[model samples]
Target: MVIPDLGRSPRPAPPHVGPRPEPGSFRDPANRVFHAGDDVLRALDRTAAADWRALAASSFFPPLLTAGKVCGTEELPAGSPLRELPTAPASSGWATVLRHERVPFVSHPYEWSFAMLRDAALLHLEILRAALPAGFTTKDGSAYNLQWRGTEPVFIDIGSFTPLRDGEPWAGYRQFCQTLLYPLMLGAHLGLAFQPWLRAQVDGIEPEQMGPLFRGTRRLLPGVLTHVHLHGSVQRRSAATSTADVRAQLRDAGYTRELAVATVRGLEKLVRRLDHQPAATHWVDYQHTCGYSGDDRASKERFVLAALSAAGRRRLVLDLGANDGRYARLAARHADYVVAVEQDPAVVDRLYRSLRGEGERHVLPLVMDLADPSPGGGWRGIERASFAARADADTVLALALVHHLAIGRNVPLPEVVACLAGLTAPGGRLVVEFVHPDDPMAARLLANKPDGIFPDYRRDAFETLLAEHGTVEDRLELPSGTRTLYRVALP
Candidate 1:
């Protein structure tokens, strides 16, 4: 059956209006980000404007922009209407506007896998290394400044680049250690997940918090002794020292631009050397272990392909519980961009490494728990957007995921369907799989549960819930008859 266009139409782009300041951008007084309609803009003060002019004229910037290592940026014409918006700095009373190429998605470091975060850290350090040689350095070392274009990491904060002073120490040193360096160390050395720690404190793990965790021999690790232990000690000892006093002391001690260059070089070496291999999880090999006969697997693939093709090309496709990324890659064939969301970090890391090696630029893998996804946080919960806030997918692939949410997570089947429906954009499609209660996978999940629980876990109930959310355009029962796939079109 053909998938009909439902009553709801495609979502339109943002309307053109006066520039609205981004909530998280208030911290940077010299430069602030604004959104006017579909354009992403930045307003800079007098000092920041001078820095921007120098950076635009720099020999390094053009090459980086061409290489896709940095976001594409251009200063708007002086008479542009966007410049007249009330986005000027309070003290400067004037603004220089620049438009930035928007990223496909904005994901937090906490939602990234070990490899993704490591790559971001490396990118940050690499940019710093390049900038220092050209007498420029980033004013801050914030992981938030980095965004992804598919698998590629791009530095988005052009305002951070500032001219290097004569004898000034690297101003963002402490921030780098806390945000990027420590997180990498946490994963590589301790084999611990850094997401929870970063989510708990948006500023990242403090030196003091990290230093105490490394005991005895662990303290001798590459960057521990100097960057963590000594760094924390110094911070504590100089808690009352003013910023001016510290810079004066560093200058008095013969700190020079050359020293700053050395610091960046040392950091690059350390970051490159640090490697993390997550312990293998069950989901990592799910594609091979999943109990689907060759013919059944083929049938499932054909069904998914036909459904996606019938729906026509998609702007964005979200694959929930994308284990091994087999289906996400398939969805990519019909999508402009695909976000493969999986809860297991190890599985996502493996998928990311494979995609990166293949140079697959359309599929982006992220670590996210469907049950408890990333939430809005910082400055009254609007600074960092939640996954739900950003996920407006044209097509949502929920293959082999409903049982996990219903039986494993204990979310009611209706609620599970509702959540999936909510993620689907208007006039979007939901390709979902429902496993029978007697299915082996569903049986295993139910084995530990008390008797008579989840009594409503039936195929009929699932289809009824699906109908409540949208029109079930098509359905297919696999050869095994234990699993069924449904294609629903939302209004």
Candidate 2:
């Protein structure tokens, strides 16, 4: 009933069925994104509205739009660009759509693996390249705007691509550094995982902040020099200047569409072959050096597969601290969507490479340290969502993760259970591993720290705490006498 009348006689009114923002609500003020009659309309402010209409009319946006590779959009109100721009929907708003085949899961930077982040950077650069000839530039370059449409990256917010004037430095330069450049540099040169840092600084790492973190070589890299060191230094040095001059200077930098596209391509090349040197840590052995016997490995695998089956069909599975996605693959079978999160850059790199080769779009790998998750704290705290805000997951696989939290990190089992419960969707499942004190992994983890403080950390205590949130789904002893697996479901 919501079909367009382009091919037929125009109707007097368009039926408005979808939810619309309440009048007077100032949500998304930057671009007036609201609902008008069953359609999502982005209201252009009067000042830039006419230019935007011209840019939209050009050959640039329509190719991707008609291909359905991008979101549906159309111009309206003839000659009045500020009025409204509407888009057709296969369904309704993003909040309530279930099993929505077109748009799948929403992912955040903290959840990206090295490759995913790198690819996203490449995609952004590619967009910049394509937009240059048409005199358009990406005003909003937040990583959130890039979403995976299958294996390839697609820009979601159509409003961000606006007509570029003669000489405006890419408006999103700082954001590009924070989200893409700094993180990529850390991962590539310093061998540091960007997830932990990204988690804390929601907006992104300031050049001033990132400058101090870099060792000598990080400061020397050419890409680092032009993009991070020099760029950030200039911004800080010029902080005293009035806002109008800075904007004008940036806009008058003689940065053409070609230069913008070239800059993006340059970034892509730099990120593709970045090499990160690994650091020494106890848990770093989770993949290669862990002294797990054959039996211990067998037990963990069996338990993991069982838990996966328990998740059943059409699951959005979350593998917390998913080192190299070894256990993530177990749940992949039952899941239509899988998000594998880990703290180590090395492990995340390996996992991403493997998944990328397989062309598996459903599994989204992220680099994250569970203890310090990404918090929402930028421009009014609404720029990015916190770890909990992003969690509407149907199931969580926290294998071999509790030991780090309880024994090594000093987190209580009850609080851990509480955190896990908070992430699961209504009636969602949680499959976690309990490592006994005698377990080799647990013993090694505790070896570095003074440990009798966690005397209450036992299987029974974990079970009791987990019971407070959900019923126990299954439990199996791992090959190691000290390790076992437990799956729980919310009552």
Best by lDDT: 1
TM for every model, in the order presented, reads 0.95, 0.76
In candidate 2, what are the lDDT values of residues 1-491, reduced to their tens digit? 01122121111234655444423223334444554443445555543355556655777766755544445556553554324333223322222110111334556776676677777877777777777788788776777667764345556666577777765667777788888878888877766778767767666788887778654865777477787778887888887987567657766776566776777777778777775645545445566666668887887787777767755663567889887677777677777777788877666767777787887766777666778776665656755557777676778888878888887788888888899888887788888888888877788777887758778888898888988898997888765567778889886
The lDDT for every candidate, in the order shown, is 0.87, 0.68
How much does candidate 2 score in TM-score? 0.76
User: Residue by residue across 1-491, what tens digits does model 1's lDDT show?
Assistant: 01112122334666655678877788878888988775778888988999999998999877888788888888898988878657453474655888888777778988888889889988988888888889899988988989887789999999999998767677778878877889999999999988888887778889879977997999999899989999999999989998888888988899887888788888889988888999998998888876888988999999999988997888889999999899999988898788999999999999999999988878889999999999998888989888998999999999999999999999999999999999999999999999999998898999989988999999999999999999999999999989999999999
Error of 2 at 124 (Å): 0.8
* C-alpha positional error of residue 261 in candidate 2 after TM-score superposition, expressed in Å: 4.1
Model 1 Cα shift for residue 334 (angstroms): 1.4
Off by over 4 Å in 2: 1-57, 62-103, 110-114, 149-152, 186-193, 207-220, 228-292, 380-382, 447-451
